[model samples]
Target: MSKIETSILVEAKEPDTETLLVLNDIPLDEQVEGLIRNHKELNITRHRSEKLALSSGPDPTGLKILPASSRQRFEESGIDVSRGYPEVPDRSQIPVFVDQAFAIRNYDLPYTERGKNADKDKKSLFGAATEVINLTKNVGTEIVGLQLENLTDQQKDELALLIAERVVVFFRDQKLSPKTQRKLGEYWGHVEVHPQTPQVPDLPGVTVIWNDYKIKQGMNLNYSNNNLGNWDATKNPAIGNQVWHADLVHERQPAGYTHLHLDAIPGVGGDTIWASGYAAYDKLSDEFKQLLDGKEAVYISAHGYLDRDDPFSGPKKVERVHPIVRTHPATGWKYLFVNRAMTRRIVGFSPVESDLILNYLFDVYEKNADIQVRFKWSNTKTGYGTSAIWDNRIAQHRAVWDHEGKDARHGTRVTSLAEKPYFDPDSKSQRESLGKYLHKWE
Candidate 1:
């Protein structure tokens, strides 16, 4: 290969004998030549050749010796060097030169008509048939102009892609029944039967989340019997509402796509917030990321669920170990898997050490508002039919309990079963994977 010449402008001061000896000992590559100077500011030129010899004199203070290919040596000596020379500009700022460029002959017409032909030729996947509105830059997207009950196979596949990419997708004014809701979930995967929550009487896999304050009824009957002692709703309602978690994390294969339709919501309260797991993982520092790499955590089912003898609650005291950092099977992006509801402790760390690290990790999800999106359910005036489908692998959701004595908030949810949680070494980060969709609105 031909010699590639390069010069670095280094701003350095005169060095003492010991500093000069340290600089001279720096090893150079066989294909590099160094030209060093001892002036107030030095310019070092490196080319493809053998290493240059150091100056040999009693007073080597003003020695002008070239350094080899080792830039670290100069950096260690506190010398600043330029990587390369600046490029010269080739374009002029003159307007007359620009006016001679290509111009539209019909520029005298209206501005809107200038691109009329181009507008007619544009094409897209959904065309003008469907409208998609992004709820936030990170987590949720609201899709309009299509009903969930009547979706074609192609539209079903497209909606699945949107759910995977956006983390959660919302639909307004959806008139879907419990059986139809279960049918909608079947397009994605097998509808999961919730272990703890009560299912609909007629429908098999559909779970009901009913919070009727009028009859003093709660979501889970067992929790109502215990007066919600696990959450301590009377003492601290804020803490009770802030349990962010994915559904059935104790299962060997957790849920994937969860579809929830709220046909009856209160007038004032009952809002849900979702946080992006990919964003949580991306926001962590490199040191913390390396520490959590290839690590596992223990998740217990009974720890989060209040009902013990519900029969459908699977094992009463079941424990499963999953990767702390898991990769979404569909998107192939890494996301933080530990949640405040199910995850107990890190697998290998001591009790004190695990608590410290897990608390810091939990704060990353709880405190960061930039990575979260809050969605409020529609009231009775709006006809009370709002549905949401979310990817459980890349998101964690929490319900806000502000409608304590005001009204009732009831909903039907169906979860789709997915593969076991696993880490993919070749997967990209959440930010890297969703860069295009995050800026779709802009």
Candidate 2:
């Protein structure tokens, strides 16, 4: 009975092509049109015979203009299009590495063991260090009065040793850029280029640590479900717990020193907790230790790839088998290397049997609060944030998503690829070496 016209005339330009006219099917409400007209970035060119609309921004080099998916998403939910269109990476110039087979990345690229000749009687770092605050009994240590970027070679070496012993070390007031952070990681060993992680455009090795940029509206960064690795808990995919995991366990040579320099943080909340692998191992019964000593488990990548063995099955995760128990080369101490997130199934064990034993080990790590240290991040938009450089070899860490990513929690992380995971039968446990014995029933 009636011929109808719609709203929102968005003029977009395609790369190497002519201009495109994009519009909505239905007419916009007057209230929504008023909001669009008021936005400084958006302009009302003209809409329909009965309604007004908005014009889109022009396309730039390597980034062709597309329909504002973000704007559409928000508008459908009764939100005004105040933010800008989100830009997706072309990934043609710089792409993510997905085929992370052990053979390709397993080759050695100059890695010397840290703390090999450590001085046991170390009190200060190059005479400028004021304190080494042990945040907890077993895991975290915060070094004060020394900046990470300005450390001498010897100081860095000692710091590496400290990290090897402490599991994780903290540094405050670092003003290092992504490149500087990359340089710092180079001193440790081979900086890893993550298989499927987004890197700093200019710097490929350094990864943006806190990835909450699902919908970037103007200056705002909306969060996605940061609780990724945790599988299930309550009915119908209830909010699963954050996973406790070591980074890059799927690599041929796994991650060693991981430096996360948080540049921005929330006013409060969003603390990360790390559990001592040594303590987790010690918490186990002697009999269980004997069972898992030399055994290996399959660790699948957090970024899954199509299983080459079974291509018909949708996206099979890349897997690397590593010892369940590994000894830290620098500390020469045995620690429980298996994590709750990635360590899938033990080798030679039936599916049910692997779940039974691995679940027990996971419980031992997750249930013990005493063996863990929770560190609250203190960094803001004003300056560089607090930094945590942890030895991933003997630690399992989980980010507390209590803030649910409402606040800005972004950082630059560089993970140095250490030697292949190894188990030494001669190495003693941290407790055994330090003579800290406990009487407990497991």
Candidate 3:
């Protein structure tokens, strides 16, 4: 990521005169002037420094006064009064407009110290060098040249930041062991233990995802010997594998980073795709965005995935309420947090209304090819373990089940739980928040 080298200068011109806040090196055309006029208490004028100075005081012709509510909303949206107001987009650039209040509310404001530490020292044990390949404009990045087992503390921290920014990062030929994978997951946060899924017999927290076509066939034979219904047609697990979802969203504090190591895969299939929540949220109209600003949704764990009767597991039915749009705690970017698998309904909405809104929102993940990254696992024949680490807080993924009953696809998964989801008005969208990083690699 590149360093930001700009500052907003706010200075008092004279003792008794109004405070003059200068937004340096920014264009001030008619559209900008009109936007400034929309916000009372701000008056724009040309400055000697080739900047636009906003004067705030008490003359009727000088500056209009802002009400307390407007000031609070402005501050909450990260508009720096001492620095300068957010840049006004041209008429052609505005996406949607309902009212002046809605326009101002949906504006993408600038942070006072945005991207200040983007260029910090990132040297690590891997010769202080790493290669990054962006897979999409906003969703995924592939990092090469570092062994996961040999990562240093600095490298781990850097990788965490990259994964958080990119949403998902892929590594090829790492062949990380279960112990090493557990260690790698620990670097980001506390590794989660699935409430009901079976773990590796000897490896404690590692969950084994063993899918073998031969083994399934044998199970079906046994079911036939017992005169049970057709296992392939009636009880196939692949029937329910197409849902797009984030891991463990039913928990109060859901899993943040989930690492999946595909050690074995089919020859031609078993590709996984992830969609960016930030992109989904950003593509919504301003009216829908405002409608979902502070709304919450209900997420319920899949039935039979949890055992409420089991004292150790605690609950058979698990449910939690999270913001419909969540701001990632680390990067301060908003993301669409609801998903098809766990999210059941929007809170405070009628069932019909919830279904209508949610179905449309779910299409953002399912239909938007521009906001997705698909990765195919083709390195299984070489015995090189391919791994994907992703921020479940800001991404939704689905496994392609086309290889069912034809080949084996096996892997191990580990998830790290993070803080509960929330919406911060000051946070930007992922693309805007990670613009420098994306541009650096581009």
Candidate 4:
């Protein structure tokens, strides 16, 4: 199909630090005053260049300290003497925050999603040559030679479009921190915050993806506990363990783009697999597609809890009705939306009939080698591992538990809630629209 895409690699010629993501701890207005007040070495009135380099320290330890007399000023809010000074950062590299935007908050608020027009910015935002590797013809793309932290707002928007078209786009060697990742999710849409889920202290929407759901254990410091990998290849995949589903299907506005930045991964098998919804929809017959279009189905939450009022009763699952054959707002293509794990039943069918149809659909997704791509969570030279950002609007994903908890796996996820599942009657299939070559068997 589409002439078997191949991976291309381009060596990075020159690196630029000005484009790197920065915390911007020092505000421009306070920079001079704080430096003069805190450090007695610098002349306050000295002319500064756009970019400044600090004079190297004379000591073998490469540490700098303010004079003893300046210790009195440290008691004030802007100054601190408790921590030793790390190297001074270049002034030009600091990020500028526009005061106009709202600060990130935990509470619920209305937000709109982007990429409605599906206008993909195919041109590289950085204007740098990069290795673009397509894992498969229809799904999964790996962007090498560029760091996620170096992207601009326009670049991030372009990246979003790329994810919409490719199903999932991955990046290696990303230096994105949890706070920055949450900020990135905020830029995409209203960040979906799970109060029950463990989160970073200040960052509300970012969910910790530690193997064990415990946070009090001091960052899995007691490594003896979380080493059990859930998936066992010897046995049939446990429905509870290897469940394939989209995130937040039970929410009124389900997940759009869910980004998982994996910082810790096993030496062997913690790879994740994603199936292309567009390709899955294309594989169905015209009659089967017609049967599913405009139909509604029930989706249940992954984790269930006891109802506060009915403690004696069993756990109750949260269920929501969504379209069976849904259309992605960006691509305008219909995809089969039901998953074996979360999706329960077709609205108008008998339980017997629904199970038969759903089993076949799940087979279509699970059995097909052509439509699926498995990503190895391999790290780059930086050793921090990879970041995978996928559109939950039109794809299903599953984590391979084969790593068996023998090793530790850790990550932070930020899910951006998109619009409710919808169907566009006028939209067409990807194969039909693009005139892609069908496999010999198809």
lDDT of 1 by residue, 1-442 (tens): 1121223223446564222222233233211222232221111111001111212111122112212311222234343334211111111210011111112121221111111122222232145337677888877988766677777655666666667767898988776666778887776666765322334444557765644421232122223332232242223222233467777676666677899887666678778999888888888766777789789998755222112224233223346788999977656778898776566789989998987887777768878998899998773234437888888877888887666635656667898766667887778787776463332222
TM-score of every prediction relative to native = 0.62, 0.74, 0.63, 0.68
Residue-wise lDDT of candidate 4 within 146-174, one digit each (tens)?
A: 77766777677778888888899998877
Q: Residue 356 of candidate 2: its Cα lDDT?
A: 86
> Which wins on TM-score, candidate 1 or candidate 3?
3
Question: What C-alpha lDDT do the candidate models reach, one value each?
Answer: 0.57, 0.66, 0.60, 0.63
**Candidate ordering by lDDT (highest first):** 2, 4, 3, 1
Which one wins by lDDT: 3 or 4? 4
In model 3, which regions exceed 4 Å deviation? 1-130, 213-240, 305-316, 432-442
Task: Give the alpha carbon lDDT tens digit for every residue of 1-442 in model 2.
Answer: 1212234334447764443233445333332332333332322212111121212231131122222322232244353223332222222221112243344476666788766676654544636687779998888998877777788777778888999988999987666666667888998889987533444444557765543442232212213544533442111111222567788898888899999877666678778899889999999888888899999999976543333344335434568899999998888899998876678899999999998898888878888998899998874334556889999988888888778666755666899989888899989988989988855666
Model 2 clash tally, residue pairs: 1
- Per-residue lDDT, model 3, residue 211, is 33
Model 4's lDDT to the true fold? 0.63
Q: Write model 3 residue lDDT over 55-150, tens digit each, in one string.
A: 322113211222232234334434343332222222222211112212222222222221123323344522454676888886898877767887
After superposition of all CA atoms, the RMSD between model 2 and the true structure is 12.9
Error of 2 at 139 (Å): 0.9
The TM-score that candidate 3 achieves is 0.63
